[model samples]
Target: MFRLGWFVNYGFGAYGWNQQWSGNVAQDVARPQLFEQGAQILENAGFDYLMLEDASVLYDIYQGSFAYAARRGLIRQDPMPLVPLMARATKHVGIIATMSTSFYPPFIAARLANTLDHLTEGRFGLNLVTSSPHAAAQNFGHEKHFEHDLRYEMADEWIRAVKALWNTWEPDAVVYDEANGVFADPDKIHYANFQGRFFSTRGPLNSVPSPQYHPVLCQAGGSGVGRAFAAAHADTIIAADPGIDGMRGYRDDITRLAEENGRSGKDVKLLHLISPVLGDTDEEAWARKRAMNAAADADQTNQLAALSYISGIDMSTFDLDEPLPELSDRVNGHQSSFSVFAKLARSGKTLREILKSRRGQETVELVGSPQTVADRMEEVMEQVGGDGFLVVMPFTRRNLTDVGDGLAPVLRRRGLIRDGYPYRTFRENLTSF
Candidate 1:
């Protein structure tokens, strides 16, 4: 059977309300409590993991909530801090935190991830990211984001350095030789003075490695550089484009990339982001989607929020209801977003038309009854060459409930999803190893 995971777009009740600039909804929502509830739902539904995207800065749409978090001194909470808490609250679910290769130091990054794995009893995962957004650079003291190739170059070396550090402490390194008055054997550890195109790091990490070797590596870049990175390192690939053909093509590409590098295609699993809108009937589900979209809108003041959110080019210059010109070369950040935008623009779609097509363009949103949703999911898996899916909830809670109550049972009956987790580590659950 295929594996499944939830992509938690934290905040909002179940399909949260929109916020103005500088707002933080986490405080008002009592986020930790909601997170516990969300974790329970996903674990009960037999999900492999839940990924919390870590963004150090809140953009304009989230300004109000962001300001609230800062005022209450709640900004100190890193997304990874919630992982262990969630792990203790649930038995089978894995926890994944996004860590950028572009920012954090190698030893620190390895220690943090290793510590979480030990705490979670080996259910921890690392979502390696080469930070994309240019604005993200400003916050980190850089003038602009590193060029795409250079960023991946740094990431390649960074991974090599960390892996060597992780292996420094062998499985039986800690003999706790009290008789010899030595807690560890010095020979068991070695330095990783790795030098590459972008960075040079010396190591043996601060902490001992966890039982799982290293946490599962998940990646979500889809450009030339991104694919190369994923092929070389990731155990699973998360992507935004959820179309059957798109996913199949991506899977084939990654597989080919992996093989060219002397690894099998099975080394990496493909997960498509599926946003399901469930109801007793298709029309009812459609109605709920329309309502959710209407509610999430910033009262039309920022009708182009989605556009601006995806493409940094600021669609405010274009008519809200009109099609946009090809702007891939002009946009910043992930190339997949640019590719999607370019495809749409090439199709001669108007802005209004493109916005309307948001039904599944952003993700594969299945609006229908449980049977309908299950059938569609199965079709995608069987036909699209997909190994699994990453579901993006419309609103955090509601998305969880929909999948748990509506889709889970259906998928379970079809033998598509497991009734319970069969593996312990996140990597084992995701791959055949």
Candidate 2:
């Protein structure tokens, strides 16, 4: 049995305006109702949380122009206000908001998360990140993004400072003792004077710690520094290591790091990414899966453009059949993602082949009838010593309906998904393992 979560590519959805069904939901991106509808669907499914993935920079790296991104609308509005909108729509489902340490100040991040914690009634999570886009730096007034290790160094201090501010007011500090005329205990409220390499905060956070202390910290760490950063600070780590062997190795390494860092390995959850194509029968499911993979042209093109944008090379100009040259120094951002792409390139995969592979890269495909999918999920969890999975499927009402009305029912019958949330707070439910 394992917990499940949904990852939203909020920014990328803006680009989905070109889809066939885009006309029907033209305002979904701009409107709160659409997001609320999706949140409600997940809650009905007994999903743990909806993690909103965000990126601030308008990506234009594909061909030294923003044409692909803008034309496709691969941009996003601010995600801050939408947090409460989603919160108001659901009671149990946690709301995970992505915020960047590299871009935002420590105190702002702390205050925002604490406020969201109160707003969501302890059902909020922070997907803390060290941003790695070229335009992100420029947008934030920086000449260039920090190096990979340096970014994590800033993030380490950023989190430490934020947590210090969050811990400024003890839980017992709030006392509505009107009879005695005492509002709160001053002794329990202390000032946070934290000074780190990247940040220094002085505060008793106006918003007291929410039910979960600080919202659950969800991190996606892929590189060596990124992994150590997650092991040191994250409560749940989102990973993309492919295959049973890769997953087992990742789990072992992170769990070991957690223990060596003075925490129980069980305290930290590891969730790998999965994209499943579900249907009623094995034949239909397999057929659907093949169609989806064959429909990989969009991902292949969009991702190649993305690869070019991130790796600082116009892959659009490269020979689709030529073996990719060594890119030891070309990448100036997201070394981890570029490294994965680079490996595919170095493996003699053509540009076309690489993009197609990217669509299914780092995936644990769970395609079959609900029962069959659940069986495969069980096998994967057992073999890899699992925490759980984060699923990313094509966005459609049917996609969610199938998972919620179809797959979840099957999982519940098998005693895999939870019958109900046992605890109130997101952290409590998330760490219930």
Candidate 3:
């Protein structure tokens, strides 16, 4: 059996990228303290990890940067820094940060992850994203984003190189031979001379080996290139889809991919993004969702955010009250956009209908009481053969406390959720497949 995890879907730019493309939820709706509070809430509730996505460039779902400042700012914090802050607040849950193999060098990536692993006491995970969109590459001084297939090809080698650097310092490399005044055993240190199509890295990283060895590798790509990268290196795969059959297909596809690459079903864990609308009863849950929907100015903000992040479509071009225009395949490479738009067209949804699909991306939304929520979760797990789920809340900690405080108990009652974290490290928890 696999464990369940939650995605921290709150905080700075929680709804969308850039200031102009907000969910219209006050700019300062959540602060650092609140983020810290959320970390505590999820950690205490037995969440496996919190993901912090990284992007070098900020654009609307349409991929435009013109309205970035008008929106607010591209993003607030450098995502890498958030890992340590979150790690300090939680004892057992993992800290996963997104780092692009396209921009950062292998040595730097390895050292940063290793440092976080040490700081987090071995509760670190790596969400390996191959940066897409030309703007993202331009920010990093590249002329253009590498083609999709090529990016994954580079990522494959990048993973091996980073792992080699990480393995440079052996488990017993640090030796406090006080009598001899030797702090490290020279024999335990090795050099990683890695040369690949995209990079040539030479290293013995500044940090020593962490308990997790290679921090739990996570992949958030859903494309062919993305799937290939995940199969090769990912320990956990993040996916967003609406139906149980789709989740199962994705799970099985990745499992087969892993096996073809010489790994097993247990080697990689599959997580579905779950945005839950929870209440005491089914009717109450539906009412709460309606209230949240009513409170949110979904039309302008949601579509704008979607256009900016998913496709390069300009939200301002479309009328807020009007039905969504039949959009062309304008996606720059992100698969999530296509999925969202497809849902809109397939369901014969209007612009508002699509915008109101789910506040937090197009992940399958479960609306019901705690028992209903847990039952749906079990169905997704047992019937779909899913490893776990990434619980995405509709609003802040105030609006949605039921996932942990309410639904988790129901899961526990059915022997689905663990009573307490049974492992010390992130890998140990995830690898118990």
Candidate 4:
């Protein structure tokens, strides 16, 4: 059996606000009940983790206006506060929150991660990201975002520093010896004293070492530098490449990079991002997929706006009826995402055609009955020499039930996925398979 995770945006985004299945999520967006319930459902389904994707800025790069994004509810709430709430609601399912290395100081990030790990009993994972949007940089008081490779370079140092801080309190550093009037062993604790090109931290962390010592590191880096950073530091890597071949290639590349970095390839789990459209029957599933595609085609402008926000390019400036011109290599936003968009453009298809073809940007879609989808997932895992799949979709009650209640049971019965978590910590459970 392989691992399973859920990828979701923790925001009042307009994603499924109009859908009946969404229930009162839109009305109760600010409340934690909905998310807590969702986390419980996933935990009961035996999912390895739930990953929350975040952004710190209101995007305005689409048509040089924030109106489209704002209307679509692109503005996001901070994800950090939601971590403990969801963690309290679920026992086994890991909660991974996206945090920006570009903005968070090493000491603060380490402390927060350590605290979350303790609160979650080691079910917490941190998805380290180098914030890409120039608007995000501006919000953090930077006029410009760092260059693609440079951001990764800074992140590499940031991870090193954070890890060093996490290590300050050794595993055996804490000892409650009231008989000796000693709370902790001072000899076991050491200063981090980390000084790197981009970050510097002095002294050890204040807290005792939590379970797992260092919480699980999660990352999604599609570019070369990003992949290298992930390979060296991440425990689980998220892959968003499309197609079976692309997925296999990405896995292979990460495996190679891991080995090159003096770590065993098997030590890191790679979860490919997928959006499965499941129905009672195969035909029904295909119909749902078609409807999804139609909705996307009708909302092409919003689609472009989202792409513009991520790529930091004014996609509205491009001619929809004509093929896109070669995009510059100097994107200050997500370079890998921009590269994927550029590749689609170079396919000689018109901009509108490209948008229409991509129903769920870069995420592979599995459309079929529950059993059929489970079969396809197994086949893909085998072909990709797998770790697992991360289900990327809008959060709705119906959507969650479709996968957690419908699809997961099929996978479990077939022994293609775990029926229950057997390990104590998330890292152990995730790596068990």
- The model with the greatest lDDT is 4
Clashing pairs in 4: none
How badly does each model clash, as a count of residue pairs?
17, 1, 15, 0
TM-score of the candidate numbered 4?
A: 0.97
Clashes of 1: 17
TM-score leaderboard ranking: 4, 2, 1, 3
Better of 1 and 4 by lDDT: 4
Give a tens-digit lDDT track for model 1, residues 1-433: 7878877654222234443222344443535666777788888887778887665554432232234333333222367777888888888788888888998878788888889999999989888888666666778998878877778888888888778778878877777888889887788887877776666667777787696888999888888888989999988878886466778888899999999888999999878888888898888998987886775442432335444544555555677556676576444566775667667667677866655555343356677889988888887788877688888754345567778877898888888887776677778877753
Which TM-score value belongs to model 3? 0.87
Per-residue lDDT tens digits for candidate 2, residues 1-433, read: 7888887755325523556434455767667776687788888888888788887877777777888877776767777788888889888888888899998888899999888888888898999888777678889998888877888899998999999988899988899899999988889998899977778889988876688887899898678888888899988888887889888888998988898889878888888888777888988999987877777664566667767755667777787777776767336666666777787778887777777777743447788999899899988989999788887754556666778788888888888877788899998888887
| Whole-model lDDT, model 1 | 0.73
Which lDDT value does model 3 have at 327? Answer: 62
Off by over 4 Å in 2: 11-16, 20-23, 309-312
Please identify which of the two predictions, 3 or 4, would achieve the higher TM-score against the true structure: 4
Residue 233, candidate 4: how far off, in angstroms?
0.6
Model 3 lDDT tens row, 1-433: 4466665543243543333323344543444554566677777766677776666666644424446534554454566676777777778878787888889999889998998888888988888888666877888888877876777888899999999999889988998899999999989998888878778878888777887878889888787767878988888888886677778888888888999999997798888887778888999999977876775653356446645555545666666556765665435556654655655755656666666664555356688998888887887688887688887653355533567778776887787866667788988876764
lDDT of each: 0.73, 0.80, 0.72, 0.85
